[model samples]
Target: MAKIILNRENLFHNLNLISKQAKGIEKVAIVLKDNAYGHGLLEIAKLASEYGIKKAVVRTHEEALKINNFFEDVLILADVENSTYSHTFHIAVNSLEQIKKLPINTKVHLKIDSGMHRNGINKKQLKEAIIGICEQNLKFTGLFTHYRCADELSTDFYWQRSNFEQIKQEVKSTCEKLSIPTPKFHSANSSALFRVKDFDEDFARVGIATYGYLETDTIFNNPKLKPVMSFWAQKISTREIKKGQRIGYGGSYFAKKDMTVSTYDVGYGDGFLRLNEKHKYITPKGYKILGRVSMDNLSINSQDEEVCIFDDVRQLAKIHDTITYEIITTLNPNIKKEII
Candidate 1:
């Protein structure tokens, strides 16, 4: 069976890196939206609590509820339909209608559309949403925006920041007129938190970086981040093949020499990619995955009793031409996870 190991030291190292980047912020809101990016939601939440993280962010009310006991505040970023806001769990209001529909006195955060255009109220609706929040007496705990290209080497991030600045000013002015105190504001995600030095926001929402993966590498200087997750699988069976013999379902690979091969309990079913010749999955010991990967297992040229599937997620992500977040989050949650 496959297993995942979480290094507590590595996790803390990553968190410390984010803390250093968030020098002036009051708090760093750890983002645990996807089961702590598949590191185990409750597990990571408890770890964060041990490290004194006061706030966290998740995608749904269910996820927020799971970790509410560990953090002082848990912000629900989406799924407003099932959300019942409270002092501990705050809902992010992306639209004016969403805010108006909220129960009176429900804690909320206003999400403004700076440039992502994915979720959040546009500039045109900003004023109306603020006014409605005051009229309805909703607890406006925070206001925030998401940047579309904060991870890329582009100038668009500055533009988004400019827009957010204007939106913040508008929010403050409107709150003052309505005799409502201005809410805490934040917009720096993992990418912006490291890339943008002048991000003097109330809070830094650190996501992928908290889990030890940087989305962008173009930025010249960066803090060292230790990967926290390591995957391993034990050999279930072993066999030897002739030089000219074919292996696996498609017989895509032909043995150039008689060699030993072992089947491990991991494959696409376990979220390991069924890679082809162009992007072959290689074991840490330099053994290549033979032929097409099966649903339940994959064959590798190794005699060892166990093998490290992946120590650094970036290797798998590069081979799949995707991001590290997808690689880690796609791992089957049922796989036994051990915190080291």
Candidate 2:
């Protein structure tokens, strides 16, 4: 079995800590989208529910259909095209057809296309559309938009935040004046979760922030969070190569001098994302990657010609210019992953 490890204990701590910063909040709709960012969908969802996180946000209907029973409520957090599960939990409406297809009694959160310009209803368009939804007689509706640079505390982000606020205020006023149930007012993701100063909101769809790494380098040193996904691998075997010897596929690795290479059962297929050959993967105690990361295995530089490859998810993530999100989430579940 392929060796992969996970740390769930630290994860709970990260969630509780991040929640404290959100001033006024009753529900923490933990973002379970992207298969819980590849941290194992069912497991993390259940864990969240166990830890008191009732609501979860999923990308498509398939993800929602997986563990709807475990969480308190599910929100199709994206504009999923498939209408097969229209009767399922609330969905985020990005277009008119989606809004039109929503169940008569279905509750949905409106996605306002703010300055982000990615996938939301424009401010004016938002106001009109939401009003139309109510007029058309849909179930329940809440308004929410995504923040593009909520993590980057720079001038560019300032503009985005400004526009976001204006839209938020307008939506709030409309919801209040027209009694439209004003969306939960969630314009923040992980980016806005920690760095947006005092973004007091009714609810926050916490995702990567809840998983550990903010997925952004906004804050470092004494940061108020801890990494939750920790991986472990074991050294299967070791060998000594003479000078001028070659290693791995295509003889990409050559020993200028006598060298010892440790082999591991990890490769790009395992979500290694083999970038240039000189990438790294970790061993149980913390041995870095060495040589080419092949489709089925990789080598590590070890001094004693003897090494241990237990598991270390972070080390692998570091190789691909990523955190646990990309690495662990991309990991093939077919491989053996045990939670520690």
Lowest summed-lDDT stretch of 10 residues in model 1? 78-87
Q: Give per-residue CA lDDT, model 2, range 1-340, as digits (tens).
A: 3554456777778767766766533457788777677677877887777777767788888888887887656788765454545444777777766777664666777787766788867776876777667865775446777777665546666676677778778777777888756666676777666765676766778887776666555453224566655433455678888999888778777778887777766677877567576654456656656667788777777643334443335555666666666765776666665577
lDDT of 2: 0.68
Best by TM-score: 1
Worst 10 residues of 2 by lDDT: 303-312
> What stretches of model 2 exceed 4 Å from their correct place?
23-25, 79-88, 176-179, 217-222, 234-238, 256-260, 278-288, 301-324
Residues 56-149 of candidate 1: C-alpha lDDT, one tens digit per residue: 9999988987887898888888865744565798889988888778888888899999988899888998888888887887888899999899
**Which regions of candidate 1 deviate over 4 angstroms?**
24-26
